[model samples]
Target: MTVNDVKMILDACILCGEQYIGKEVHTACGADMMSDVLAFVKDQSVLLTGLCNPQVIRTAEMMDIVCIVFVRGKKPDEAMVALAEESGIVLLSTDHRMFTACGMLYEKGLHGGASD
Candidate 1:
């Protein structure tokens, strides 16, 4: 799905990287644990998380994630947004909780990436 598609599905507001809305993202992963995200996610371009920290952006950078959805109406602070903007990772916020957000995306055909 495209970033715009995900936004529509999640009713998310774009916080940064608006220009990347047309980008295609085949897989998604929803997790608040940065360690699980790092260990389990591979080629998952979209990250849905409730964690609103600079570490989330850093993890996205390390995992080459293209977009992040801060679920349950969570918003990152200025530094985190700046980091995501600098990393060219799109940031979106939604009212949906992590489970609902992930379920919505999954129902819309976005699946998790392969795990080793």
Candidate 2:
């Protein structure tokens, strides 16, 4: 599905890189810990996290993630938004908790892209 579809599914607000909302995302990984994301996340995925920081942007850059959805109403700072914008990574924020957001996406056919 596309990032715009994800935004509608989760009722998320675009915080940055709105131009990239049309980008397609076939996978999703929700984690508060960047370590798990770094270890297992695949490329062209959407990252759903409660942690709002610059490191999240850096991690997305390294992993080639297409979008980030900040859960539980958490919003990143100006610098983080700028970083995400610069990297062409779409940022979205939703009031839903991490689990619900991930579940909603999963129900819409977004997987973690993880292997056994």
Would you estimate the TM-scores of all the predictions?
A: 0.95, 0.97
Q: State the lDDT of candidate 2 residue by residue for 1-116, as single tens digits.
A: 99999999999999988888899897899998999999988989999999988989999999999999999999999999999989999999999999999999888888887562
Question: Which window of ten consecutive residues has the lowest lDDT sum in model 2?
Answer: 107-116
Write out the backbone clash pairs for model 1: none
- How high is the CA lDDT of each candidate model? 0.91, 0.93
Q: Where is model 1 more than 4 Å wrong at Cα?
A: none
The candidate maximizing lDDT is: 2
Cα miss at 33, model 1 (Å)?
0.4
Instruction: Name the best candidate (by TM-score).
Output: 2
lDDT comparing candidate 2 with the true structure: 0.93
Alpha-carbon shift of residue 25 in model 1 (angstroms) = 0.5
